[model samples]
Every structure is written in C-alpha cells, then in structure tokens.
Target chain A: MLARLNVALLGLLASTLSFAGDAISATEKQPLNLHAIGMFVLFVSMTLGITYWAAGRTKSASDFYTAGGGITGFQNGLAIAGDYMSAATLLGLTALVYTKGVDGYIYMIAFFAGWPIILFLMAERLRNLGKFTFADITSYRLNQSKVRTMAAVSSLTVVCFYLVAQMVGAGQLIKLLFGLDYNIALFVVGALMMVYVTFGGMVATTWVQIIKACMLLAGGTLVAVLAMSQFGFSFEKMMGQAVSLHSLGEKLLFPGTLLPDPITALSLGLGLMFGTAGLPHILMRFFTVTNAKEARKSVLYASGFVAYFFNVILLMGFAAIIIVGQNPEFFEGGQIGGKIVGGGNMIAMHLAKAVGGNLLLGFLSAVAFATILAVVSGLALAGAAAISHDIYARVIRKGKATETEELRVSRFASVGLGLVAIVLGIAFEKMNVAFMVALAFGIAASANFPVLILSMYWKGLTTRGAVAGGYAGLVAAVLLVVFSKSVWVTVLGNAEALFPYDQPALFSMPLAFLITFIVSKLDNSAEAQAERAAFEDQYVRAQTGFGAAEASSH
Target chain B: MSTTASQNAVYARIRKNPRFAELVSKRQGFATLLSIIVLVIFYGFFMVVAFNPNLIGQRLSEGSYVTIGIAAELFMFIFFWVLTAVYVKRANGEFDEITAEIVRDASKEVK
Candidate 1:
C-alpha cells in the first residue's frame, strides 16, 4: 500500500513539475488597477525579504516544521488568528453578512467556537504529545506505521481541500480588487506561497501569518469604526440605516431571510464547531510553542483575537449594507443600475474605499492580498509536514531517515503542494469559494476531529478502530459532499442532488463516532488490549506533560 | 518500580500512585465539564437556529433594530470566550501545579 501510494504521488508530482510555471489564462488583457497592484507588490516584496532571512536561519527539521518551537504565545496567537481569518473570513464572510444579514453572524460565531473547544480539550494535550505533525500524537501508543498512514492520508486530504478553497478565494478576490484575471491572480498567489514555504519553512510562515493577522485586525476595526460614526455612534441607528438602505430592507435584519432551512443550519453547526479543531494546519500550531502551558496561552490569545475580529466583522457586514449599499459609486456600473461592484465579495473593499478613500483602499487591498498568501503558506507547510515528517521520515524510512534528507524532501513537498493548489484553485475559479471552505471544514470535522479526540480520551480506541473510523469518516464526508446540493446539483449540473442536504456532518459525524466505538468494543485481540492498557500512560503524559518532545532552543 | 524504564512500563508504576488517580480524575473531569458546557451553548443555539429561525430573527424589542438572534449569539460567543479564559486560568494555575507535584512524587517513589 505504501509503495503504491508513493508511486502514485510521485507520478502526480512529476506531471505537475512540467506545468509549474505555466501561463495563467490572459491577465494582461485586463486594465490595471494601479493602487491595488502597487500595494500588493509592496506587501509581496516585504514578505519575500522575511522569507530570505528565515531561509538562512532554518537549519534542522524542527526549524522547518515547528519554527524550532521558538514562537511566543502572543505571536502564535496572531499566527493562528491569521490562519483562521483567511480571505474567506474577511471578505467572504463580510459579503455573506452583507447579503444574508443576520444569518451571517451564526456562521462567524460557529467558526470562532472552535477555538474555545481547542483550548478546553485539545491544546495542552497536543502540545505535550506531538512533535511536528498531529500524527505524532495520534500514533504514539497505537501501531505506529498504520496510524501514521491513516493520519497522513486524512491530514493531506484536509490540507489539499483547504488549499484549493483559499486559492480560489484568492483568485476571485484579487480579480475584483486588482482588476486582474482570475487565473493570473491564482498563479501569482500560488507562486508567492511556494517561495515562502520552500525557502523559509515554518519560521517564515508563522511571521507572515502574524503580520497579516495584525493588519487584518487593524483594517477590519477601522472600517467598522468609520461606518459606525456615520450613524452618530449608535448601533441601533446604524442597524436602522442598514435595514432601510439594504436592497432587502427589514428582511435583511432577520436570520431566515438568508438561511431559512433548519437542517442545513444544524449540519453547518456540526461542521464549524468540530472542523476548526481538526484542521491539521491549525492543530500543528500546538507544537510550535515550547510546552503545554504555552499551548494554552496561544489558544487563549487566539480566542480573544478571533472574537474581536468577528465582532468587527459583524459590524463590517452592517456597515456594508448601510454605507457601501447606499453609495452608488460602488455599484458595478459605478451607479445604482448595476450590481454591486465586483459582486458581493468586493463589498468589504468597497466599504474600505467609501470610508477611507483611495489611500485606505490601497492599504486594505494589500492587507487582503497578504491574507491569502499567509494562509496558503501555512496550508502548504502543513501538507509538506504530512508528506515529509509523517509519510517519508516515519513510514517510508521506518523512522531512520536523516535530518538533512527529511528537510530536503519537505522542501520538495512544499513545492509540489503549491503547484497542486494553483491548479485546483484555477479549476474552481467560478465556484462560491466560501461554500468550498465550508466543505473543507465539514470534511475535517467528520474525518480528523473524531479520530484525534477519541485517541486522546478513549482508552478503548485501537488501531483497527482508529483506522476504520477515520476511513469511514473520510469516505462518508467526501461522498456526501459530492452528492450534496452544493456539488451534485450546482457544480455537476445534476437535476437533483443525490444527498438531501448541503452539510454532511448531521449524518457523517455521528456515524464516525458510532463506528469507532463499536469497532473498538468488539476488537478483543491481544494488540487491541495492549493498546487499551497503554492508554493510561498516554493519558498521564497528555495531562502532565511527561515524556513530551522538548522545544529546541534556537 | 525502578527508575529505569522497560520501554512503556515506566508509566505502569505511576498508574498505581494515589496522586496519579487524583490528578487524572480532577483534570479529566474538569475538561469533560468544560467541553460539555461549550457543546451545550453551541448546540443549544444550533437547536434554535435549526428549530426556530423566526425566534432568533425577531427584534430584541418592538422598536429595536437588533434581532434576538444577533443578541443571543453574541452573548453566547462572548460567553464561550470567557469560559475558555476561565478554564485556562484555572488549569494553568491549579491544574499545572498539581500535575507537576503528581509527577514529582510518583518519580521519587519509583527512584
């Protein structure tokens, strides 16, 4: 299985290598948006400088994977917030709220809820358990090779889907912001991400995320503040203006006006609450801190930042409706007769422009571009870790691979992952990328979250159970998502969806939990008993930070 | 109960320590409770969204522009963050010190 998978991956990589720097449709045909482009270039060059410095310092696998465990709690907080916000949360969520109104708040809250869950249950234990990748913790007491393989597959799947979603979002938003073609925007972002990961690794990725987080927070807050001042600093007056000025009127202020269905709402709740914890890129962050203590601190800081950011995002949504919605300059034709300029995703930028004018518009556009690059860099680094640290070093080499060899393979993996992201991003260019990101979160919730949480808490979990449960979840989520209304009916042009609902977690999450429980209960094998007996030690270590991987002092 | 480990067997001795039992129960119980509280808040709101969309969509008051849904979820969101801070503060202050003590006593006995 391992050899065959390796061959398949290598084949995929080889095919991609030829197309690495290929053309991205025709971008030059479009008129240049000088302000956005200039700011984007300025931001890119600054990040490139950081990447060069990080490249010189990144020496060992620890440095490549977890930034040598040297990240402070506050910095990790910013980076984690950076990873979570993405263009989807910033521009996409803003658009959703602008269009959907009250329904949008539910989605943002669900996204933020994952942080508290992580802090309460997973963060400290993961820091005390894993080394670089989350697979380290999951495979610790179970059958190492088997668990690693299972974890690597799930981790890669989550990262790849997340990568495509972020890339597609980057493409569409850049086109809107910069007047560039979709394909060109994707290609540029993908290439920039590849440079960051291939050159600077985790150290560079973390700093980029931190800087992006601060910028996003500052920009989001300013937009909200300016919008609020319009109504004499009264939220009620602002909301009144939002309802009255919005295309939908008072309906826009109501929840069901956008999301009327309860089933989809319940299912989406499942995806956001659990999926945020399961994302490999997010989970891998726990190891970047020195100990369980720092891990907790990081989550605390992250929770605060995420909550604050979302509060501002909620305000941005209403602001768009009140301020951006009223201004005829933002419409597609620069008048009220046409649709909002660049569709809904551009509303936040339009709001920035309306409140802050061209100078603020340039700054916000640059910040949004930085948002996409920072997120993709983090995703690529996680994918590389799964391939190199988990699959290559632990599984293929039987834990005997040299540090130099591992680091080299990791760089190659980063480039391979970046290329794949560009291709997938272009393919999904026209899709609603916010929905695509939701699907990614759903997959993580069902497949990875169950396995990781159970491994930590349940002594009954065995290799058979973990593998069976994980694969069951991975298959169910992928299948259900493909058949759901979003894909089957919408993307695939089917007359009707094979699945009744868009969110799969209502069915898939429970099924995963049930299967894992039943399988572990029935497995009476000697190895199963041993794995069960070994749980006490794993639990002790998870709780007390005993036998944890030491943070290297860089 | 030697200080030298026979592979995974080092932890087997600590398992018998009274302190070990106490630490595990306290920490696990605390985590379980925190998780349940969050789940209830999240899923409870979810239930409302799932079952009664109109309930949340209603205005906070007759004249207010803010909907009950917005007000309620915001309360829950801020509350959840507070709960996390509460858990982290307690664990780092109370739990970590207990963990260190438990590990120390268990190791001393084994040595």
Candidate 2:
C-alpha cells in the first residue's frame, strides 16, 4: 500500500505531460477497454468473495485488528509485499528508469534498504509489542493518554497525506486506463476500500494485498522475460542499449538524476530509509503474524519478493527506453510530447504494447488498478485504527471502552475516511504524486520515527518529551515542506522558497531527537521516574517476547 | 500488566537473570555490527553522490561502457539482502535459542 504511492508520484507527472487531456478525451469518446474491464471484474468478484468469508470470521477486536494472528509467514510476506507495492511504484519507478536512468535506481535501492533495518531492529520487537497500530509501541510504556493522543495525531497525519496521494493518482490513472471519468474512478476505489475495511477488516485487507502481490510479481516477471528475449537474456547488453539510447548517454548509468543536491540527497535518503519503520499501515502488518519469529521470517520473504520485483522493473525500464524511445508512434513531432499522449510515465505501458501487444497492455492496466485498491484498503484500515482504537478508545474512554464498541467505531471510521479521501482526491487531482508522498515520508521519519525509536531504545523518555518532541518534528516537517521548492515555488507559484532545502528530515529528525533527549534528562518528577523505570521491562518484553501478548484463539 | 509499578518491577527482575544478560549481549552485539555495515554501504553511496555526482557516470573499466556507480549499487543491493538473510538465519539458529533459554529461566523467577 505504501509502496504504490511511489507510483502516483511519477506516473502522473510523466503520463500527464504526454497526451494527458487528449487521452482523457479519447478514453471518454471510446468505451472502456473491454478485456481490461473483464479481468478487473473477475479479480473484484474473487476479492469480494474473500471479504464475505472474512466478514463472517471477523467477530472480536483481535480478529479485526490482527486477523486473530492466523496468517502464515509466506502469506504475511505477500501481504507486506502487497502493501509495499503501490500505484506510485508501478507508474513512478518505471517512469523514473525510463526517463531519468540510473538516478531512478536510487529510489528502488532506498525503498529496499529500509527493510533490513526493520528486520534487524524493529520487526521482531514490533510484532511482540504492537497489536493493531504502531502507535501502540510508541505509547507502550509512556503516559498512555498523552502519548497515545500524539501518536493518533501523527498517524492520522501520515495516513491522510498518503491516502490523498493514492486517491488522486488513482483518479487520474483510471481515467487513462479504463476511460472512466476521474470522479467515477475515485468513487469506485474509495467505496471498495471502505467495504474491505468496514466488513473484512485486516483479514480482507491482507487477502487483497496477498492477491495483488502475486499478480504484480507475475505481471512484472512476464514483462521482464519478454524484454529479455530482445537481448538473449544479457543484462550487460541491455544496460549498453539503455545508455546508448538515453539522452544522457553514458551519464544515464550514473546516480544523481532526481535530487543531485548534496544536502537534499542526504535528507531524502534519511526520510525514505527510516520512514518505513514508522508508517502506521506497514507496521500494523507485523501484528497479523503469530509471533516475533514469524515476523522476522515474513520480512525475509518480503525483502526477497520486493528485491526481485524492483530489479525486474528496473530491467523493464531500460527496455522501455530502447523499445519505446525510438518509436515516433509514441512521440509527437518526433519527440516525446510532455503534454501530448505518450511522453513520460506511459512509456512503460507503451513499451508493453510494443513488445507484447494489446493483451499484455490489458493485463498490466488491470494490475495497476488492482494495486491502487489493495493499497487504499491497507491505508484505510490503519487510519480507522488510529481514530477508533487510539483516539476514541484509549485516549477518550481511558481504556474503559469495550472491544465490540471499538470494532463498531473502526468500521464507522473507514466510511468516514473514504469520504474525506474522495474530496481530497479531487482537490489534489492535478498535484504531483511524488511530492505528496515525500511529504508523508518526511513527517513519518521526523515526527513518528524519532518519538517511537527514542521511546523504545532510550531509557529516559517521558510523556512530555514524547508529546513535545513529536509535535516539534511534525510541525517542522510540514512547515518546511510548505515553504520548500517542491511545493512553494512549483505549486504555489512563489518566486522563491522560504526554505532553501526541499527535505526537512535532516534538520527536523535531529531536532526531535535532541528535544526528547534534553527534556527527558531534565525530567525527574514521580511520573517521569516511573515511565523511565518502566523501560527496563519494556526492553525485555521487546527483546525476548516473554510477556508480549499472545495470539487469541477465539 | 495494568499497573505501571508492576511493569517496572518486571524489567528490574529480568535484569537480574543471567540468561537475559546473555540474550541481550549476543543479540545486540550482532545487530549493532550488521546495522553499521548496512549504514556504511548505503551512506557511502550517498557521500560519493554528494561530493561528485558525475563520478557515478565514469566508465567502470577502460571500455566496458557500464558506469562504475551502477555496478556498485547493484552490488550494494545484493549485499544488503545477503546481510539480512545472514542475520535472520543467525537470530533463528542462535539468538533465538538464547532467547528461549532466557525466557525459561526468567519465567520461574517472576512467578
């Protein structure tokens, strides 16, 4: 789910420039692609059937929260893969390789790099600690009411930014793929996501993710295999072709295409690498497994699938440059039209047709839409957890809320979140997906990550430190982004940016850590002492899984 | 579990267990080493890019045509994955054995 927002970021930018309006109008004039619609229909029927089965089985809060800890390692791995691959990935990363060349590989590497840290430091501990939301771990031993409130706000902030990016990207993507109007596309995705979250909960969400992962893996491999047939399966020959055809020539094989600025590169790197550990939706997936060991195993499986998937897509991107770049059929005036029909992001889709014809195009288009659906469901579920489980149940009710009542509120929140997403989706329809997601990751890394990591590893963290430090990071990230080049100059049409740097994580992350440390050191009150003293047990629970919550059998 | 005081005592008690000490040291030692390796490899790329972004485009060997940076990144990617596999393998085969032993010894004392 988080992975695909990477899809929206570049897909819209590149695709929108090439034949954005013309394709939208053409798709409107013609009926939707029948084969693509048929496959989508079949996938929908199967998933809804699974949701029906899951709804009947989802009885208790644990069932809704963690799927009763029933998912196998392989299945959880697939689910994590599903959540990891998003519309942004499908459309954006491919386009980056097709256009930017070697620099685009930075994103692919950064995305995978985080999983190892998660594997080594957080995954086993998280599975042992958090039940429904990652916020659970952040507030595990702190002053529950205050810390959980901060967690809920931080979680909701990240989810909203991510959800809007997905919704907007989906709205534009379906318009080009299915020829459906943007509003209709948004409504269909929003409604379906609500159904999966409200009725099926985590059970339905996990199944959808698993299904999408398999489909994506199958679809990506087919494209790569076909592309390889051109070069007799020679990786070296393929790279040479991309380098020769690329406008940058040999330079295309090097790094620094996206963010060449040293400070910005460092900042963006920090954000993407650490941000995965704190994303509410991704962390919540750990709870679906039976134990910490299973959690470790799942990351192992996910890393393999993700590594294979990105590597194959990287190959296909290079292939697109060779296959699609020379075809003036995909260009306007003998050059890729940034505002025409097939310029930037659609290069991969066009290359699919160039290599495998219409059948592959239909299959890929269907996979793209399915990825958006799987991603939105995961985000919606996480958002509802923050609202119903963290805010309404823990903070407001002061831990007196009933399980049934929390579950009911969770379903209700999903529907509400869907409505909000629809409105924001339309509002940001023309916004760049990459910037939206960067905002999400930046806040996640600075605000959510700092507080959670310090709380888990540091012994002196207090309630005030967590709340104060978290809000400081959150405000810094958002405020810096608002005044930075990506948004301030480009979108807002300002002459100059208030913030010289685009990424805030480099500054904001340290600020949050520093504030938390200083405030914690000075805190010697009775409550602060207790919270600090509680860390020794929390450390043991996190490490050995001795007193961690057990899998429910009901 | 419900009260803060009781939870604090739980950790203090576990701290006294020799097995818990063994589990923490061995696991954290290996983890810190792995984390340093991953960070160095990733940040090493960032530092190179930060100083000389164009250095990445330099030809790998006199006439191969593939950039050195590309080859380095692919190597880093594969190496990072291998490191993770190695860590999980050890954690399951060795670290986990220690964890189980620690939990077993500590549980009796807590009760």
Candidate 3:
C-alpha cells in the first residue's frame, strides 16, 4: 500500500509538472495590467485611511492594544474573519480542493471545529482575565515575571513562524499575480504590513483585516457562483466531474486516506483542529472585544462567516478542478505535463484568471496581498504586545511604568518585530508557507494551550507549574518540529532527519501538561496564604468580569 | 470575610430567583449538553469517515442525485449553525443572568 501510494504520488507529480509547462508556455505573453494595479492602489488607500482614522483615536496603551475596548460586535466579527482567514485559506485550501477533491475540506473542518472550544472554554475567560496577552491569564496566580517571560517567548515564537509564512505567501502571490520578482513582492508586502501595524496598532490592523476579509469572501464567492453557474447551479455535477477526472475516490472527502496510513490522517486532523485554538494571532482577538459575552459573540460571528466563506471556497475549488481539468491547456508544465501552474496556493488566483479575465485576476491578486498584510500585521501586533505589555510593563518593570511609556515601548516593539519578520520573510522566501504555519501551530498547541487551560481551571496551579509547563511545551514542540521530516528535509534540505515524528501533538502536549501538573503539586504551598486568597478572588473576578467593574466602582 | 459571605448570599438569592434559576439551570445544561452532542457527532462522523472511507466514495460520481457526500457536508453545515444559534440564545439568557448576578454580588462587596 505504501509503495502504491508513493508511485501514485510520483505519477501525479509528473502529470502536474507537464501541466505547469503547458500553462507557462501558453500564458508567457500575457502581461499584467495597470488597471489591476490601479484597483490595488485604490483598495490599499481606502483600507489605510480607515486604519489611520482609527489610529488617531488611539491615545493610550489600551487604545493602542485593544482599540480602547470599543469595537462593536459586528465590526469585530469582520475583523475576526480578517484575522482568521489568511492567504492560506483564501488560496491554498481552494487550490488543494481544486486538485485533491475532498481532502481539501479537511482544512475547513479542522479550522471551524476549533471555534467551539474557543467559544465555550477560552474566549470569555481570556477576555475577563488578561487585558491583552495570553501571559496575563497564565501568569495570573503565578509570579508575574515567570509568566511574562514564558508568555513573551511563546508569543514571539508563534508570531515569528506565522509572520514568515505570511511573508513567503505574499512573495508567491506577487510573483503569480503581478509577474514581479518574489523578492520584490516580499519586500513590498513586508513594508506595507509594518507601516499599517506600527502606525495604527490594533485599530488600524483590525480595519485592514476587516477589509481584507470582505474582499476575500466576496472575490471567492463570486468565483464559486461563476463556477456553479457554469454547471447550471449543480454542486453534484461538479463533484462528479472532479471524481471522474481525478479518480480521488474516498480520499476526496476523507483526508489522509490518500496517504496510505491512519496515523497521517489523525495527525492532519489534530494539527488543523487543535492548532486553531492555539494560534497566537487568533487568541489575541479575544482581548479586542469589550467583554466575555462580546468575545463569545465574536467567535459565533467569526465561525458563521468562516464556515460560509469556506463553503464558497470549497465550491471554487471544485469549479477549478472541473474547469481546469476540462481544459488541460490550463495546466502548467514543469517536470511533468499535467501539474497546475504555481503551487497549490495559486489555484484560486488561476481560477479567477480563468473565469474573470485579467481584471478579476488582478483584483483577486490584490485581495490576496491584503490577506497576507492583514494576517502579518495582527501577528506583529501580538508579538509587540507580548513584549511591551506583558514582559516590559507587567513583568520586568513590575507594573511601575506609566501607560505612556508602555505605549511607546509597544509601538517600538511593533516596528522591531515587523523588521525582523521582513528579514526572515526575505531569508526564507523559498520555503513552503504552510509548513511555517504548521510549525507555529505546533508550538502554540504544545506550549500556550496547556498553560492557558491549566491556569484557567486549576486553582492550585502555581507560578512554578506554569513556568515549567510552558517552557517544557515550548522546548519539546520546537525540538520535535525542527527534527521532523517536514522541517529537516523540506525546510533545511537534510534528508537524514533525527526524529521520525512529523506532528508534535502526540508527545509535546502531554509532556507539557505533565510537567505543569507535577510542578503545581510541588509549589502548592509556595504562594502565601493571603496571596492565595487574593488570587482566588481574582479568578472569580476574571471568570465573572466583575473584577474590573468592582475596581472601578471602588 | 463576613462581608464576602453576605455578598455571596445576595448572589445566591439572585441566582435562586425561581425564574432565573430555572432558566439558568435548564439553559446551562442544555448548552453544555448540546455542545457535547455537537462535538461528539462532529467527531463521530469524522471517525466513521476515517474508519470507512468508502462510505461516501461510491456516491462521488452519482451527479446531482443527492449523494451521501453532499448530504454529509450539508448536515455538517446545518449542525454548525444549530450550535451557533444555541450558543447565541443561551448566552443572551442564562449566561447573561449569571454574569449579571456575579457583577451585582461583586459590587455589593465593594460597597
């Protein structure tokens, strides 16, 4: 079975290469239009203006970090969509479904399934506890310094991985859509994202995300509608055509079955579902809402919007499969004759170009660019907040710093983080964006999620426990991922990898939880009785959102 | 400590109000149970798919004739919305009341 799967994959690869060659030769003379560039500029300008307008209202650290906690449910809903729906969702999933059939929907299922966990468990508590960062919650009962250090490290790690992925994606999208060099695209996207985040903070970043989400959904839906219309509004016919042409069989709907093993299937599922809850960028959005209820509402809205958008993307992918398959000339030839042009990420863009001409193509391309920018900006902000607010003000300075000073440091951190991302993006431009994303998710799940879950529910959870658990998860996940086949072979170009593990969830997550549990048991009496009482009071306050209101009333 | 106990009493009173208690108890259980069922059914379906990939594979080429795959996908979408609607409703009613009670209790403690 393994040999057969390998042979089949190789065959598919050969066909894909040929398709790429054909596509490149056929579209070699097709130049990018200035009209697309004009539309791109107009869209960018509008989003930037909104961001700038919002930034003007940001007068304090709270405003800079959480938009003064004034974002409406509807507005925050759109921003949530913007933040969660990245270039990967817009393009990669569409392309995957286009090429691989049902396997593509795995991404959608995993992404959406994680929301319930967020809604029921994380969102409200997160909103009520820490003002901005995950560190706030984990470090609540523990020593603030230990919490800050672990939280910052985790946030930075996730943000760096996520930013690099978005940057790499931006480079690819620019090359495909604008016919520009990958390096130029990466540089342009990096600069734009840095400016938007550094200048506007959460306020600007939120609006930019909202605009990007709207465009991606609209653009993706339009293509799906067009594709369905071509099939006389029949999804069944589209699937039929896909299955007939591709012979995807059960693998179309049940992902990893195509991989010749159940372990791979489970790994993919775990990665998608658990990874969503742990993503730093996604988790940070909980802090943007005013209250726990609003936070819950935001998740509901985000889930609904994301599910709807993904359905449209699913249709778009099926459309591409049928449409592109019907016309083999559409395939770009590389080392083989049947492979599609670019990687799996280019399917949606190619579909737009196929159906809507260069104008639609350009529009979608610009939306893709916006998608990368919005995601990276949010990531940069999270990284900055973790450093400035969580570490510097709360931990290092021991809450002595003024709000003004904190805001200054946060803005500076944003700039620094953005520059770091730009450099990394340029450096790793050739790597797969999805791998970077997966690595971030792995780290987040192993390190942050355990710390978050344990701290919120476990009253006995001590500072030592959190630190031990957090660092353990962080180190274990990073080490496992670095040694995994995907990173070692794919990213580092080393065939002989040390560790056989591809997914770190089965090991690192449990290890982190175990370490935390043991440490908490040992440090049970370390916290003073008075401090323990105060901490219990804080937990109730955090859970109820009464803490802040009670403080203000006093 | 006595002040905190008194505050807790008032909170318990607010929580124990017949209408509020009934609503809170019913909705909280309902939400929790519904969420569990949704997650179970969602994962259960995936588990089935994992174990039996051929369940929907045969219907792939059936073409607009209401195949199992299409039905399953539609069911999943509907299930998702049902869960969302349940959450929104319960959040507005039971969860909101509990939060209000807690807020009131905390405020009294401050006084």
TM-score for all predictions?
A: 0.93, 0.93, 0.88
Q: Using DockQ as the measure, what is the rank order of every candidate, best first?
A: 2, 1, 3
- lDDT for predicted candidate 2 compared with the true structure: 0.82
Q: Which stretches of candidate 3 lie over 4 Å from their true place?
A: A1-30, A247-260, A333-337, A496-498, A528-535, A549-554, B1-31, B58-70, B105-110
Q: Per-prediction DockQ, in order?
A: 0.58, 0.62, 0.29
Kindly list the per-residue Cα lDDT of model 3 for residues A1-554, writing each as its tens digit. 32343344345334433344333553432244455556776776676667667667777777778777777667788898899988888887887787677766755776777777677666667777767777877776667787778888988998898888888777767666655556555656766676677778888998898888888888888877877888889766776676666656435654443334455555555666667777777887777777767777887788888889988988888888767655655666532226666655677877887788878888888888788888888888899998899888987788999998998899889888877877887888656655677678778888888888887777767777888988998999888888987888877899787876577776788899899888777764637343355455555555456543111110
Deviation in Å, model 1, residue A243 alpha carbon: 1.6
What is the CA-based DockQ of model 2? 0.62
**Which is the leading candidate under TM-score?**
2
Write one digit per residue (lDDT tens) for candidate 1, span A337-375.
Answer: 368766667888888988889878888988998998998
Residue A234 C-alpha lDDT in model 1: 90
Q: Which segments of model 1 are wrong by more than 4 Å?
A: A1-31, A334-337, A431-435, B1-10
For candidate 3, the per-residue lDDT at A280 reads 74
Clash pairs of candidate 1?
A: none
Docking class of 3: acceptable
Docking quality class, candidate 1: medium
lDDT of 3 by residue, B35-108 (tens): 68767866665665667666654553443534565567667776776687678767766677866865665456
Cα lDDT of model 2 by residue, A1-554, tens digit: 32243244334334433444465454332235666766876677778778888999999988998899878788999999999889788778888988888877877888888999989888888887777788788888788888888888988999999999999888877876766668767877897798888889999999999999998999888988998899899878887787777777766766644776888888978988988877889989999898888898899899888888888878888988888877777765656533325336676677777788878887888889999999999999999999998998999898889999999999999999999999999988777656778888889998999888887788889988998999999998999999998899989999999998877889888998888888888888899998887787788888888667678885
